[model samples]
Target: MHDHDREALAMFIDYQRAQNLAATTIANRRSILTTFARTTGTLVDCDPFTLRRYIGRDARITAGTRRTERGALTAFYTFLHDEGLRADNPALKLPVIRVPKGKPRPFTAEQIDTLLASGAYTRTRAMILLGYYQGFRVSSIAAVHGHDIDLVSQRIRTVVKGRKEVWFPLHPMIAELAATMPNDGYWFPARGGRAGHILPSSVTNLITRAKKRAEIAERKLTPHSLRHAFATDLLEEGVDIRVVQELLAHEHLSTTQIYTQVSEQRKDAGIRTLAARDIPTSSGRGAASIAA
Candidate 1:
């Protein structure tokens, strides 16, 4: 029984290949199946008990992790059923776990001012501003060439996430930074000439080091956090969530909806503003007392 189960797992990998699953997906399936095999004892003698035990053990892991395992098991058993072996997917019985809600954390306005003030080089300053204001992913930022920026138009055409091309209009500050930078070099230059597109790690490290130098704590500052700040700032400014979604190049509207949840403090402020207008003056207070 164990050997038969092992054979079933191997056959499933082949089926995944035939379906043209992405390499990453293929790797994950292999990992999950391998975990199942190990947890089940010898595959040749395995039974449904082994499957249940594996899931039960992983129930102690986080909901997100268990969900991943559940998905992999479902796929595995589906393959087995198609191959005329197992008739049911035991992993389907796994309970779903809810992921906690989290807001996009952005840098304070003061921190942004300080970071830009610290970077001496015009090019470095522009790169930081671009990351903060335009929300370019590191790859998109690195892809920026002297030619891609249209100063006359005050816009940059960035290749984002392979399939998407996002053109971000430069804010006045960003435009000024770009204007000061040399138009001949990679916006953030690397060595080895053309092949030396700026590495994301290099900029991430630069920001991390700069934050440390500026005495900013590790509580919230990060390179990607700047992008989140960019989007959130726009939302806070009353920009439509749909427009922000386009600016951020989010594929799903739900991804953009997360930022719409304002902080509790802000909500309280809004309520206070409304309440202030309805407060009675002295004469109105007397009229209300007489009516009561």
Candidate 2:
């Protein structure tokens, strides 16, 4: 690679670190920049056409992956432009890849009951219950410590994206479990000498095992599925979308609005409501014939 390209890429990565971006984000940016340097030989030589060609060459990747690549390149080029290393940000012109959104696959109430009664360990059951009731992400759930729960106030504190701590009321079931937990240390302690609470993968594995035991492994439920169920259930019960968004800790209202799509059960209930409506009695002979 050209020395200028190498130096520019290194500087860009350092800038990302200074911005306190996540390690995963930095690593992904580094990988994308390195690939660009390898393919185009130098950042100085790249333009919109070069970047577009590189992105289009990888047809096997999903639209989501393409979007990530585009974002990384856009940010990198913007950095270079800001530093006076380039005349323009070529990546600015890159077209966004639009991916179709799929309806969330949440667990049915009966399935949730069966999964809860599937003979899992107490801690595992508690974890599942928390996810379903609170709509917490797996990482947020794993990071939960005993002190985060306030039994007196019936509140549980959790950190969401952007490292913001949010407190919400605890469900009665989760609160009951919390009452028996130790005062200090992780409520769901990590296994095998790991530090802090359990890893998200461990939570996922726990859900998988419980799913198998419940004979619903075929349903392909994950911890996040419970979270989806939580939001969807609240929406079905006439909870406002904004309220559901807050409960789920969603940053955008649009993200929470996806749950408003009517489920099969909700659709059937709507039909049933229409069917149950009473027709007024008519006094005319034709009305009697129609009724008969």
Candidate 2, residues 8-42, lDDT tens digits: the string is: 88899899889978655788889887887888776
Native-to-model Cα distance after best TM-score fit, residue 85 in candidate 2, in Å: 4.6
**How does candidate 2 score on lDDT?**
0.84
lDDT of each: 0.71, 0.84
- Which residue pairs clash in candidate 2? none
Worst 10 residues of 1 by lDDT: 39-48
Any runs in candidate 2 off by more than 4 Å, and if so which? 1-14, 22-50, 57-60, 84-88, 117-119, 191-194, 212-220, 275-292
* Candidate 1 per-residue lDDT over residues 34-153, each given as its tens digit: 766775654433456665566668345765666677688778766666666766655555556566765777777788788777753555566677788789866666657777678899
Residue 288 error, candidate 2, Å: 17
Question: TM-scores for all candidates?
Answer: 0.63, 0.76
Best by TM-score: 2
